[model samples]
Target: MKMVDTMCNMHLHNYKDILEIRRNTSDFMWCSRELNLTKSYRQYHDLTDPYKFQYDVFRSTDIQRLIEEVSKCNNCSNEEVSKHVVEILKEIGHTRQMAVFRCFGLCFIKVLKEVISCVFVNEAQILKLKSEMGGNPVIFVPSHRSYADFLLMSYITFHYNIEIPCIAAGMDFQSMRVIGKILRDCSAFFMRRSFVDDQLYRSVFKKYVQHLVTYGDAPIEFFIEGTRSRSAKALVPKFGLLNMLVEPFFNGDVPDIYFVPVSFSYECVLEESLFAYEMLGIPKPKESTSGLIKALKIMDEKYGNVHATFSEPISFRKYLTQTLSATLDFTKRDSVEESGHCFHLAYQIVDCQQKNMVLNTFNILAMVLTNHLMVNSLEPLLIDHVSKDVVWLSAVLKTQGAVVQPISHGTAVSVLMESIKVHQSLIRVSASGTISLVKLNNDKCKTLDPQTLRGHKLSTDMMNLAVPMLTLQLYVNPCLHFLINSAIITVIMQQVGANSHINKNSLFMKFVFVRELFAHEFVFYRPVETQEFEDALTKLELLSIIESEPLRLGNHQKLQALFCNLLYPFFSGYLSVCRFLLTADNLEWEERQFLKSAQERIEEELISGWLLQPYCLSLDMISSCIAALTSMIVLSKIRRGSQVHYKVDKDRLIPVISHLESLFYLPQKYQTRDQDSLEDTESIQVISSSEPLQRLVSKL
Candidate 1:
């Protein structure tokens, strides 16, 4: 674990040959990510799907029989579900390699704090957090970046000698061959897609999650956004699992609920190269057997410790109050609270890591410089850069006593920064060290307020297309747009004594930037012919883009993120005018071009002319919607280069607000059947005969 200035009798730049010597001398050692396990994995019975976790012990066994015999049940037997899982796991052969259940069950049984310290860079931070929490179920909900989350969580819980809770995964991969067995073993159950007509499945999932939380058997894990975002920036939370995660808390069995928002960080992502290809208008590929192989080799034994830090928990009362407020404002509770918690926690822990962990000056320089290098607005950032940015940053953070270790010199800084610049999400790194941002979050990062001022300005194209930069990414804006504009368009049309049928069929189109002000000339999303779709998608697959069809409402499941990108601008433009500005007439031609693209390519979508669509809802109502959106960003002082962008003056903006007041402001249309018992059930008692569950309570 110690660093040395020289290699064993080696000259400079002999690292490659040294690697060869190590490979030849030590069988356990590996370099260039090669595990030399192709032979073992090729063993016909060694079926392993890296995309999903599949556990053998859970499959081909009577886990349900054991549970039922011990606990008893009134509903349909789990025998059938167990059978499905076993069958799938055996077929895919992926069940044997996963460590999820082993990690969870073992941690629950052993409760060793050493396991945690051994695998994390920020162990002390967590220890302090644990002492503060003093025992409650702390939910670790993070942005879903990869399947690695399973390992990261498992390792954290294992190291701390605590039991991490079961997670809820989609039926698609979680229930698929081999992967399903691993998930079930890890206490993960299948969650049905929202569009599925099966209410029974959803109910079962809700009840299962509730059982886990109410009994305090394990802490629960969930992804706020539901799925991994295509772009790297976090996406808004999808409510599919939120209601269930909180169900136990609402029932009152637990006195308090503490939500531990965790931020998962990695020096190098397993899926980076794969995701880069996806930004070039290619269809993304699914995690196939080969991809799984790569993932397993990389994961089964990566030397670097994964970092998972827990924030202070919140009581159930606070969560419930915040939840209600969020639902009312059409804002997410986790969004308001967790974002702050994670961001602050990440910076603090990362700062701690620099000083306490073995991070040298190289890492510090690389981390900051690479980040600065990615900034599109160089003038502003460079002014910060040439002034010895990281040095100043370390000094500023130190003024508040943040633990940022100093670097050796500017040389170490430049090398590390160059290395980081070589590795950026969605951004292409050229041989010459020139860089361009790529859209890594895919459609998930599509924001409503993105380039609001830029509109169709070609120079701001990167902001419009890729995951938003810290300076450019607007997390709260897209939800605001969707809530205020798309959903309300129909409601407003119905209220104003307009066409009722028109309202039902309309939905908004997602936007894409064809020509933008800031986009590099080398970066672009090209339209592919039908024959090229498969190939392009293959390349996208190689790029590791997370592309899930969020809403497959069409008779034909032909929706693409690109298509969404193409259509959203018009709808956003329309909504802006209605909600923020009086009109779009004052905006220049660049602002109008965004609408022009939507109009010209409108027919590309299957729902182009269909009634009840977000775009074509009226007067061709879609145009009016775009007009409203355009005005919001365009006419607002934000776009006018005023001292404060989007500054709302009550009297001046009230009229702008009044024009679109009805957006997302609707009466409760359907009452939830399970609203009465939002917390733990009264009938349940939380009892632990195990060490892990006992630890979870003590820590929470």
Candidate 2:
């Protein structure tokens, strides 16, 4: 729980302090000095000649098998297959040179001092993991946030004096000239992004990874999310790489494997700007040496602290045993069944990573500040107001069993001010000591209202908001999974009053309904578990927000306000998208066509002052909402030749939009009386109209 300062002013001399903290803390146990490498690993690397080891054992059998498989197709000669195998080996294989690793380790530490303020590790869990590593292959499955993730894993291991892992990097990096070679020298192996039709390459790559797990002694490291999370939330796990890494244990080639779910939290993501553009449907630039050289200029700027936390090791043998017990004859299962098992395992790892994520001071502050902007408009938020909200949020998170960063209420404002300063474009402070959102540049702004010259394009506002809010959203995204249950309960309680005799079955059904509505808007690991729903109910009862006997609820005014703030972005975004969809000229349209049309209409609405929060214009989230509508039969899918089209059912969608709008719109009384009223109060107007459906249809 203590912070480690690795600043350069200290001469990079914090090792003694780290060691002392480890000694005092019961959670961390240092590894034995004599056991740097396992006996088998030592024996393998101790050969007098490097070529002898390579000739006898470096994926020879797998390469032969791949060559034979390729030769069977008669697609190429034996010599060609052999040459392909050689190229694949060079691409996927790692050279574990201790001297090279040490050199890179020192260089990484020095470079990190310039780029980041500090690097924090969860020492106790890491030490425990190291202690348990000798019996099985150890795998580190970290959430991929940046290119920095790959180096961070190796850096931490080397810092701890443990054997460095062989990292699985994308083939994009392998093409980066000197950087690629240096990465390989530092024990990184590359894999193609997709391997659908290339069976020869697939076999070679798969066998290369298997050889590492089964025979190589170093721990294996890979991203379970498969790639960086573009939206900064945990993505549904990608099973391709996880399946290959775990296959050794399933095939009995290795006794067992231990997976350590690692979570990383950064104060400032290096690629935040690029990720924002990608979210707007722009293609990400490919990795290149020139790009690397250009990026080096930013090295002079400071990116804040990063925290890496490791969770308890998950035993693969035990998990498989438990999972297969019901099958009765797992060994007789087909490839499909095996794939299913791998998918289940992938989900389990994702869940583990989610739970391991530590909500730091920066993310919590971002959540409070973002919500403030959403409810209060772009006006300057009082410093005291932001600080008060942060305290409230931190308390709420702690009660829900989340790991909140330890910051006193008095210090919360300072922390928030620091975070805002890091991303200067997000917020601007006035001379009067109030904070306001920085508007987008005039060149980037598009006129939504041609007549008045006041209309702004949705993309313009989105781009402007993306500068500050997108990065803020990244910090807030991790906590959404934790807050969703409470959010649902609060929304339900508000809808169904304390005087009503609510049916438990009906209540749970409604909860599920709301959960599915925003499934795409939020990163839920899976469907809401029954136990979680029950727990939420119990929590409500304890807080007197609801009663169990008659299933009644309480007023809980403060709780309602808190929940409303938390869910505003998602609920508002969904409602806005649905409203835009209803304006389409044709009901039946292909998905891509629908999205393009929706984007245009949304921008038009933004110009017309129909949408309030520009950050809500997420294309992916809009698509997810459409899919959810499809699932609920509010939108029907129609097949037009080879294309899939959607037909919106206005009859069903009207009530859905009304209910969500009610949840999203904040009451005028909720705001401080002194604050100016928002000009774009169109949402309130829509909800208050007696014939809402008729009004919406006429406007369209």
Candidate 3:
């Protein structure tokens, strides 16, 4: 087996548009009577039938062993639990029928061609991965961005002659009428969104996932994030599937397992508008056949390009010995060490996904526009000015380790114009050559019934900017992975005046506080406070904004301002949550009630001009703030039946609220000293790092 280093370096120029070759193939041979329909195809020779794999799972020794253990725990007869296990295997299993797969592929190909301009992939990476196949189970862990992720992997593997992976899909898709069975036949296995209450089902799922890893020939694909990131950012990974996938290797059932990290970048996301509505208080529409049919309207529009990059396959055995085994004992399955192993592995995959991401030109444009809006929301951006900013920002991001779409594709002006044409709905260039946001009608938001609202109902005034601003934020999100560290440092510097020389130890504590405060807003590898601080300092130095030895801000005011603007909206939202908690007359409130009222409070602040960013009126941010506060023990939850209520700990929260307030009140120009307020850091809640880290990890 071939092994690539743990940190795989992805070259932006290496990817080729796989669709280019597909479009050149003879239509007759590509569609009907293709290689997939032929008996001598690679899949036929190299892979076991998925139905046979399911049959083996149903009767596997692992399932039988689990049944015995579950029966003993539940005080049920072996026969009863055995019957339940069998029923579960039937429900959770997938069958890959070639005929149905080929039929769907044919139709999907046409849709892809009509809607998307190109599908870029690193053919060399796929070929390298193909060589690493067959000795052990291969787990394909992709970052989920859109529903298109499910189909993109299979499409690429089939085109490359690799066996299509049996995907772990949500049960929501299982009810999509004709699409459900077709998806199953194309190798999709359904699982409920959650099964923590159903012990029998949980046991079955664990054993079933292990069965696939231990015995199935094809690769197994699942999302590390567990769901589509409506914010277009990476989410904290869930460990349930990672645990199950690695159990076989620990049990000695398989020699080893391979974990592959896959990333998908869309120039223009198909569900961009829907995701924007979801960011506000609008409820997501259910996945139904009607919804799927209605979504076909996207075919008439352009979704510029979709880039898929596969990182090096990580060797489970080697990773265990070289990384986790140092501190964890693989012998104890339920021990804290075992939990740490799962989390480290999950974080590694998510990190790799971010490392290999391909940033589109629009991602850069979005960031520039967002910052521009911060200075002047209503003014139209001139094409020449935006082009210059895009070029400068692209260079800045590249230096900070981002793989931006090469400017060699065209001049910055032409590239910017082309990207605007692709996203004409969200942003537009008028005949007079001024670019501005396309706003959603206020009447559209006014018609939503209160019960149908996902969270708080926004006032018509707030609703005017809600959709466009949120959607623009979504585009800006993909760039956060590169900018997050520097942004954090910038906010810290802004808090303490530019001339202040602070102790590195004291600075790191504040860094920890800010990082944890937004833990739910961003995805990060935990238990690495020291490493993250050093990296942020390194990145800040790389950007020439700070000197690392004594940690002093540089004289580059423009660059510092960019970093500050990038994170202002999120900090504004969190500050609003903290302020709401500080002033609430009631000490305790239900969780659901808190989210609505907090958002309402923010809406009022927006109207009164106390809030700086309109996009800060977000339920998601408010909910994340509540989670962060709860994890920190600044707020404690009380469970009443199915609903959970929170009680504020004013003592712990006052410091947090004061700390956030002081940062904003500092000189915005990053110059002058707030000597008295600098002393207030003595009161900011001191976190003994590890306890809060473990608490948050345990909650996840």
Candidate 4:
């Protein structure tokens, strides 16, 4: 393996060094000869380091100050513009290598000669698109699906004889040790996750993009949901990059910057089926080298082929996503927060739960096909059963005459069973041998807690649920229900104790406070009614975040672990900060799943609560519970603006009061019910109590 790799790598260096050099350049531009002038360079060094060559070539030139010099130009001096141009060129170069590798695997370079000799200009129109790529270094924004997107696009650019374009990828890729080091040496730039929040980093990265945009060949590019869409659709556009593009337009710094929407259709994505299964909560370990070899062997035993289509471009930056909001017929008001993430163009590829794959004919078909099978009593069906909603998917495959083996109900079921055995998803014995797709949390996620500032490693089962609705094609409706159920945690919280006397009117004020949020976060959608969503108060009461619970559960109960994991979503913005009424045996697996998926929704709601003050009454019992809910000891402290020290009880509550006068309760007409701690204990056995305050805590 090492010998083959070394020989292949050496071969890769010889054929593509100049082009490779261009890819590695930060600001330098070169004629083919300047790039191809490696005879002396290679011989002088007696070695090949893509990075060393890149830095040496560029540093040897005057490109370091290229941007500074360009910025001095009144005719064309936008730092942002220049950076994008340079970045695009490099992105193109790196993408080419990746593209070849995808097709030829580890032997890409070894097979390159044959492929180039045989494969003619695949698409002439694609080859001559630069003239049409108008302004702002035209960037092709396509929905993300598999990691193979980078390669497919690069191949198209190189085949078309177009100039290599630089690509912008996340820093995570650059962190892959030697591979990352080599990629950085190529044109791929390092972008930190924090760059999304910290504008300074964004500015620097944006400036780099602008520079690249002005320097390279049509700077071929696509931002995969800004990062990589995990769900099978174009996720929300990270307007941050879009905003940078818009800067030139708004300032008249450059001519029109065109944004062409490219629709990519894949018959079989290298990562499609597995990635889909994974994101759908399937527990398959990543295909290791040996596993990949095994899969390849299987592919050879069957048939392997791929077909892709590049849709006509959609341009009109003036009518970008923000300008054209999609109005789905169904309303998921509870998932307004997740909806925001959906709208942002940038994405992060974590576990299947965190990322969304790009949507295409295959995924759409997969979903329709899976649902048809799952609904038909878990009997997998043929593509013949594909639904009209996802029919375009079939068309995409049929047009290319796909080589995939026909899947009958029996065969499909068999394969699905095999997938489950490998842990791509799970099969539960509940409901007489029901299959539920689930991904177990790995060690990295199992030990985390978003609540503990230092313990961000998520508990496994809970993390499993927080992942987005990647299998949207299969359980779109069920997913919606699950989200709706999870969303209720905060939505109906203000009214948890129906008979409680915490002023009803004021209670309404402490809810939803909906704002920009993703739909898949906290809003779990289930196909049917679920108690986890239905029993909001019971969960909250148990969480001890609400002072209503008489006795908190022993931390070791299965319920406590479940609640902690599920509630992480609530705290982390899946559900808005609210209380769940937790109690003994309050939820089953169905309920737990609903609770787990509510993180994004809860987080968004928490934001709204912060901005809108969802905790309407200063005396909200839940807030007090939140103060004392953790295993940490509850402490007495002075209110932000008050003088007297307020003490919190074991349920983690501090008495909330309103000053009616300079020295009296604020609501002078309000009556006070002075009851002892023991007096309110009776409310536990019954669902409700008569006292106004007690009722509010118990039933109201």
lDDT of 3: 0.77
The residue-by-residue lDDT of candidate 2 on 1-700, one tens digit each, is: 1111111111112212232333244321222123355321332454333334344443477667667767878777878878767766776777766666666655555567677766777776666667666778888889888888888887778656667778898889889988888888787888888887788778778877787787777788999878898677787677787878877776777777888778777777888777765555445777899998898866776787777777766777666566544343434546435546666666666766666566766677677666555443434567767666666667667666666666666686787777667766555666776765565453333533333221123455345554455556777778876777877877776667546767889888777768778765655534335777887887766655567777875544555555656666567678777887676567676777666666666555544545544455556666778878987899898888878888888889888887776555542113332212111111111122122222211111
The digit string of per-residue lDDT tens for model 3 on 214-261 reads 667778999989999988989889988888888787787788788989
In model 1, which regions exceed 4 Å deviation? 1-100, 103-121, 128-136, 195-197, 276-281, 294-306, 318-387, 393-418, 421-700
- Evaluate model 4: give its TM-score: 0.41
Backbone collision tally, model 1: 83
TM-score of 1: 0.42
Q: If scored against the real structure, what TM-score would every candidate get?
A: 0.42, 0.81, 0.90, 0.41
Highest lDDT: give the candidate number: 3
Error of 4 at 215 (Å): 4.1
Every candidate's lDDT: 0.35, 0.65, 0.77, 0.33
lDDT of residue 243 for candidate 1: 57
Candidate 4 residue spans exceeding 4 A from truth: 1-136, 196-200, 272-369, 372-700
Report the lDDT tens digits of candidate 1 across residue range 1-700.
Answer: 0111110121112111111232235222211122222110012232243233334334213444443543344444567555654554333222223345554434332222221112333455455545544345566665465566765675455434454446666666653555566566555645555735643344334444554455433566777657764333344345555556564544554555566556554434445443322322223556454555555443332222233434334444554345323343213445545533333322222222222212222233332323332211222223223224345323423332223334433453354354344344323444644434344333422433333422221222222322222212111111221122222222332233211222222212111111111011111122212222333333222222212133112211111111222233333334333332333332233333434333323322212211111222111223333333334433343454323333223444454354434332211111112212212111211122121211211111
Error of 3 at 30 (Å): 2.3
| Candidates arranged by lDDT, highest first | 3, 2, 1, 4
Off by over 4 Å in 3: 1-7, 31-52, 65-80, 326-336, 377-380, 408-410, 548-550, 665-700
How well is each residue in 485-552 modelled by candidate 4, as lDDT tens digits? 22333333322333333332333233222211222232222211232322444444543323333322
The residue pairs that clash in candidate 3, if any, are none
